[model samples]
Target: MSSELETAMETLINVFHTHSGKEGDKYKLSKKELKELLQTELAGFLDGQKDSETVEKLMKELDENGDGEVDFQEYVVLIAALTVACNSFFWES
Candidate 1:
C-alpha cells in the first residue's frame, strides 16, 4: 500500500481497536462487528445534516456484495470516505 493508504489503515485499525476495547491487539473484524463499530463510533460524524443520506448511500454503495458486512477492502474504502468527509468538514467550516 502507498504511505497514505498505510497511514489511513493504521488510523482505522487504531480507531477500531479503541472503540472495540481491544487495544494493543491486531484482530481483524467481522462484517457485523464492523457495522456495529461504525454505528457506534462514527454515527454522529456520518449523520451530519447535509451528508447523512449521502453517507448512508455511500455505505450501501460500498457494501456491494450485500453480505451485510464489509471485508478489509470494503472497510478501507469506508475509512477513506470518512477521512475525507472529516477533513472537509473541519477544514472547510
Candidate 2:
C-alpha cells in the first residue's frame, strides 16, 4: 500500500481504538464496534443526526457486500471517502 493509504488506515485504526476504549496493540475491531466508534467520534460533526439511522446509512453505503459489517477494506474506503470530502470542503472554502 502507498504511504498515504497506510497513514489513512492507521488514522482509522486509532479512531477505532479510541472508540473501543482499548489501548496499545489490541486492535481487533468488529463491524458493530466500528459503527459505535464512528457514531461517538463523528457524532458532533454529524450535527443533530440520529445516531442509529446515520450509522445504518453509513454502513449500507460502505458495506458493499451487504454483510452488515465493515471489515478493513470497507473501512479504508470509508476513510478515503471522508478524506476526499474533507479536502474538497476545505479547498472550496
Candidate 3:
C-alpha cells in the first residue's frame, strides 16, 4: 500500500493536472484554470474573499517567474504553504 505521505503527494499532482491544460500549456495553469482550481478545491477557504482582485493577487504571487502562469513547482509551493498553515492550526488547537 502507498504510504500516507506518498498518497498526499500524489493527490497534489493529480489535482494540479486535473485543472490544468484547459487553456494554454498542458503542463501549466492559466489564470482561469487557477481560478477554477482555487474556487473548486479551496471553496471553503476562498469563499471568504471579498476582494475581486484575489485571484489576480494569487496568480501574481504564485507566478514566481512572472510567466503569468503557474507551473507544477509554483503550485506545489502554494500547497506546501497551506499544508503548513493547516498543520499549525491543528496542532495549536
1-93: candidate 2 lDDT, tens digit per residue? 569969966777777556543432234435567666776766665578876677778777887777566656777687778779999999988
Whose TM-score is higher: candidate 1's or candidate 2's?
A: 2
Q: Candidate 2 — which residues are off by over 4 angstroms?
A: 1-9, 17-31
Ranked by lDDT, the better of candidates 2 and 3 is 3
Q: Could you tell me which 10 consecutive residues in candidate 3 have the lowest summed lDDT? A: 44-53
Cα TM-score of candidate 2: 0.66
Top TM-score prediction, candidate number: 3
Better of 1 and 2 by lDDT: 2
For model 1 the local lDDT of residue 40 reads 77
List residue ranges in candidate 3 displaced over 4 A.
none
lDDT of 1 by residue, 1-93 (tens): 569969966777777665442322234444445555756777775464544455455557777677544455676777778679889999999
Q: Tell me which residue pairs clash in candidate 1.
A: none
What lDDT tens digits, residue by residue, belong to model 3 across residues 1-93? Answer: 999999988998999999999999999999899988988898876876853478788889999999999999999988889889999999988
Give the alpha-carbon lDDT of every model.
Answer: 0.61, 0.67, 0.90
Q: How well does each candidate superpose onto the true structure, as a TM-score?
A: 0.49, 0.66, 0.92
